[model samples]
Target: MASNVQVLADSWIHLLLNLLGYGTIIIPGYFLIKYIKNSQYIERAGNGIFSRIILTCVYGNTYDKIVEDTIQAQKPRKERSSFSDCSQLIFCFLGLQVSYLTWGVLQEKIMTEEYTDLSGSIARFKDSQFLVFVNRILAFLLAGTYLMVTRQSRHKAPLYKYSYCSFSNIMSSWCQYEALKYVSFPTQVLAKASKIIPTMIMGKIVSGKKYEYYEYLTAVLISMGMTLFLLTSSETHKQSAAATTVSGVIILIGYMAFDSFTSNWQGELFTQYKMSSVQMMCGVNLFSCLFTSVSLLQQGTYFTSIEFMFRYPRFFWDCIILSICSASGQLFIYYTISCFGPVVFVIIMTIRQGLAILLSCIIYMHPLTLTQVVGVLVVFGAIFLRIYCSHRIKQINARRAAGIDSAKV
Candidate 1:
């Protein structure tokens, strides 16, 4: 009887332990399902404490009418006056030029210049990730401030969508900076000018958009010109030849791919959400800061970068100014894309690229070969030809639309 009792007691204890283990797993799984369902319910109902917290924390607005406002924003709105449109375009173009021109100069200075540390040792700021983090965090702050000041339509897009854009954007910028260590600024600028092809490729992939025959032709011309320019480097340009290594070419290719994706994705979001430029900026930069901060922390360079900043006052100020320019440039970028569409924005940026190359050559005295000059002219010619053809296409479409309207009348 005693042996039977002992066996039964042991079996009961084993059964209890098994039940406890199962309970631990089942309870959390049940709660997770309930939590997700509750969140979905809140989204559909557009009310409740959870929804209020999301609106306030994510959007910086706690007004009870946010859902209604978002719905109303989706409705068709009146067009702006032609004069207002022109003025906004002027502001966007000028803002982009001034802000990015300064940004380029400062970027080169920061990456290339040597500064004295507190220990009296000369060091260059090698933390490109830190620079990225600083730029993004400041842009986030500025964009948030703008959104708070100006009344914007309630944003309805899922916040996580911005992460896709932010990741590509950060990678592209990091590539740009890192490539400076490998290539001349002119080379980099010209390489970026060749992004038209990549943009079309990404457009097709991301948005399933089709292109014209002329676009393909221009893309080929641009590629040929780029190859010619890269191959025909001036013999005297030892630094240029030495810097334009295979690694530099690889990094630039990555930049083009990532940047093309970024622009296309952002444009899609604008079309889908009809969100304001500041709202887009705020959303993208918020995720940008989050990703970069986590990266910097994991790499253990966050505090070291801060210490480096304190050691060199000029570098610190340069970073601040760089961040300001970057923030301002971002606002212009989104506004231009939202207003005139990505094609017009790309045209403006292409022009800026040409000017940026010229500016870098003049200030930094980067030597250009005769072939390089011809190559540049060829590339620009192709670009301008593509632009002209695009313009004619638009005109033809407009005329056809007018004809259809007149016939209907």
Candidate 2:
């Protein structure tokens, strides 16, 4: 059985390499279509042979779909209790879960593998930094290709326009991986779950906007839950608890601080530029790839990592899978936020994180202390409470508005 699984894995690696090598033939054709789409005489020249072929093969119904979707988004959409909406929600939920789980599993597998006997170069290159670098580059390439194919560029600003957000995002991702070495995955997640607190604080500082009472309460609950979880975690790892906590706290502090700004920055960009999710993703990742590339070179691991990858093809395969999952996960997140409101999006993500913790414990056989369970429950309760409070507020406001209208009548 083990041999069969190994063979299957090897087959996949080979297939991925072949696909990567041969995928460039369509590049020229893609750029040609993009140029034609951007040209003012496109309609008049539609009868030309080259234009006809490009329109048939690439544009066809896609052109109409993009225009219709953009127009629909601009208008006030009427909410409908429809089967299609339900199906879309279900589909997005499943896709997000699978993509996220797959990325996490692949990362853990790569990091925890038997690298002790490997050469120093191979060991060093297998760190979270390398993984993140490769993932960002892949995502950038994919996003660029998407733009070329669609002939769309919503934000024409320089790449540096997104540099700060991209840098913070990449750093947050790196810190998540770094913290994994000191704390268990569940512990790392619990630490990240406290991001709501810092995010609220940062949002207020950045935008000078006050949050609702429920938002503040929710943030407080999450902070308390994380504190409880950390306290219990120390008790479990009594011997090394001090060192682990110090290191984990440092890493997680960086992660949370950077993460708190990322959402706000992205929101600012969207509001200012009216950029689509793909445009935002492409811009951020393109700059992130540049930043990561510089870091890898500065650390002098770029060549060594390539050498290591050549020696162990499986490592390369895992990185490729990680990249694909990261890209897909981002798109799924954007799609969910666009289709559903942010509240539904947050609820869906909360569920995803809960499942991730559960699955990590099951697969890794990590002990979830009773206190930790309570912490999880507390965090989840806060989320549910926020949802209930929001609903109640909306109801009260609606009734008050109706009363005012009746008085005016």
Candidate 3:
């Protein structure tokens, strides 16, 4: 048995497996994007309760299904809307709270564990301990189960849908998970701002969407806000010493880029494939699980310590909670991006960031400065600016159509 195991664990074999895993994380994005462009629903809803083996079946007539019908007629789309399904909003709120809290809390744990960012995160994966092994298993199980259940209840087979949207969703998640292992919570928020650039570029290329002058101005303002916050609030600033904050900032930037890619790609998906948020999410998570599991195996032989949760129940419990939090936050983030445009969604996220920052100040009591306050305000302003630009553009298009109608008349 041991010799057979060794045979299977050849470096070449393991390398192939690992690459496949990493590929799983991003490759599906192509399909996801294709789904977006196809302009229709591909996945179905799961049985109200999710199962590990099932793939959520998307409504058959997804392309033909009216958006308002899903939002109004049956299975709940977003609970937050004032529509009849508003009650689902309560769970949705709890879901959002759990998601943010988990991201914030796990982020703190990562720091306590002395991780700096994704580039460095691979190191932690190298150190094999029973507890972390258990964590890998649990994370895989929880996240994977959710993915499968979501898929069974929500999606069609890979054969039926566009691959670009699915793949983009997978890449977006892969980057975020990898980043979470490295950066600080607040820095992550700052990093989230980076998505704007990618969104703009993708929008122009894929969606044929042109940016207005104000949009460019808003991007500049967003950059300035980030710089001010970095300069004013960095630990180096407080100590009056030069130091490297580069790692922290880089992790966030990575997160921001992938996140914006997720959103910007959505517009293309909507224009091209017309997939629902849930459908895309199902694809992303399914791919994420496959890759995460493969990555865990390559990190070390995990089966030996799989039962550690039984030995250190407390640690196991903590990790479980953390994983749950992580999962919830991820779900909320994806949902938010899908429901609200990326700009509006991030604007809502800033609320969570502000709360986290305030608590960080109270807990560690980090020194607050006027510049820091201004920085936060600047982010908010940029978010509002994006929303305004989007709204105004919509109105202009509406009027353009009305004018065309008059011309035809």
Candidate 4:
């Protein structure tokens, strides 16, 4: 027993060392970016650093003024959409859909199977926490660079708040990847349809927000739809590896809770700090990179994942594509929310989810039962009802404010 305890302690020490090494990388990378941002020689020479080249390619100029203008293109306008605006909107919508679909398929493919024999035509592909780490790190680096170039790095909130949000964000990411290993993409999407329920519950619990009767009814419909869908999927699970599992459902539930809490926390922080969407994205992703790095290091997954990737170039490219798609989707999501309101964003996402389910079923040849069809319809109905109810509430508030203004006059 003493020897066993000693061995366990030694393992923990090794894990600690690994985590420290990852920290060394993150800290130096962050400082290097900051140093590059402040460098006078790069500004005078206009061609000294790689960051300048990237900024020039992305923004047509390496100067701060030009980068600022290019970043402004991301901002959503409240005015009428021009022809250029419409064209850009279409491009963004398509990009968002394609990126989301690609990542979903790639993740499912990577985790679905492992080759048992060397004679297999394709190499083994497995999910790695290190892949998650790399994804976060790459995204963070890109976002941080944008902030630096655009002079937005000065708008960060407290590191502690970002750290807390990062923990939740990484947890959501981890749960999602793990859940995908056990659940079909369509089933997982269906389960996630009830995300509004958790958001509502958390709002009430954490912020004391009140909801209307119709909203509660809509939540109930969503819950019923998800339950019905699950019930109808039992036979599918028996035949399909991607079918829903209890473990997957549980993990999804945890994901919903964590995601809801994190979103609300972010809202609270934004309100308190008066930060922009760009700053929120940068800060959350930056800290998320730190958290995931520590996790992959302590788990010692980076070495194994890297080794496997070297052997299977396809898997390596798949992981990279997954990360790129995810980042692209995020940018489009932010652009959409900024251009349109949250309601419009919700509608677009609802449509996207429907298409994803349809495409997944067609591509994977998964059977959808009549009960599931009805359930999906019910869920969609609930979503529309929520949208209508929200509009009604807004109208009521508008009329009340008008009445008060008239009374004051």
Global lDDT scores for all candidate models: 0.74, 0.65, 0.52, 0.63
lDDT per residue for candidate 2 within 1-409, as digits (tens), equals: 6864564465345334323422332245457556766874346755778765555444443455566668868999674544676689889989989998898788778887744324543352444666777888888888888888896743433344476687677767766555555555446546655566676666666555567888788877866775566555533243222224465667678877887677666655554445677877787787677666666675577778777767776777877988999999877766665555333454465556556666667777888889878877887798779767866787798799999999999
Give per-residue CA lDDT, model 4, range 33-69, as digits (tens): 4665577434455555765543432232224444554
What candidate 1 gets wrong by more than 4 Å, as runs, is 1-39, 43-49, 53-94, 117-122, 176-193, 222-253, 343-353, 360-373
- Per-residue lDDT over 1-409 for candidate 3, one digit per residue giving the tens place of the 0 to 100 score: 6753464345236445555756664466556545654754334434454421322222234434456346546765542323422344345545676576765666456434532332433212222223333333444456556656664332323322433443445445444544544455445544554455666666676657776888777776775676566555545333223222454345345555556666666555444444554455445554445555556666655543343333444434556676666555656655655554455444455345445555667789788789878977886698678667766787798799999999999
Which runs of model 4 end up more than 4 angstroms from their true locations? 1-97, 113-123, 151-156, 176-193, 226-253, 332-354, 360-369
lDDT value for model 2: 0.65
CA RMSD of all predictions: 13.4, 11.6, 10.2, 9.2
Best by lDDT: 1
Superior by lDDT: candidate 2 or candidate 3: 2
Could you tell me which 10 consecutive residues in candidate 4 have the lowest summed lDDT?
53-62
Instruction: Give the worst 10-residue stretch by lDDT in candidate 1.
Output: 233-242
Q: Which 10 successive residues of model 3 have the least lDDT summed?
A: 122-131
How well is each residue in 262-360 modelled by candidate 1, as lDDT tens digits?
A: 988988889776788889999999878877776666557899999999989889999999999999899899988888766557656766755555556
Superposed Cα deviation of residue 212, candidate 2 (Å):
0.9
Clashes of 3: 48
- Candidate achieving higher lDDT, 3 or 4: 4
Write down the TM-score of every candidate. 0.73, 0.65, 0.58, 0.64
* Strongest candidate by TM-score: 1
Q: Model 4: C-alpha RMSD to truth? A: 9.2
Say what the RMSD of model 3 is: 10.2
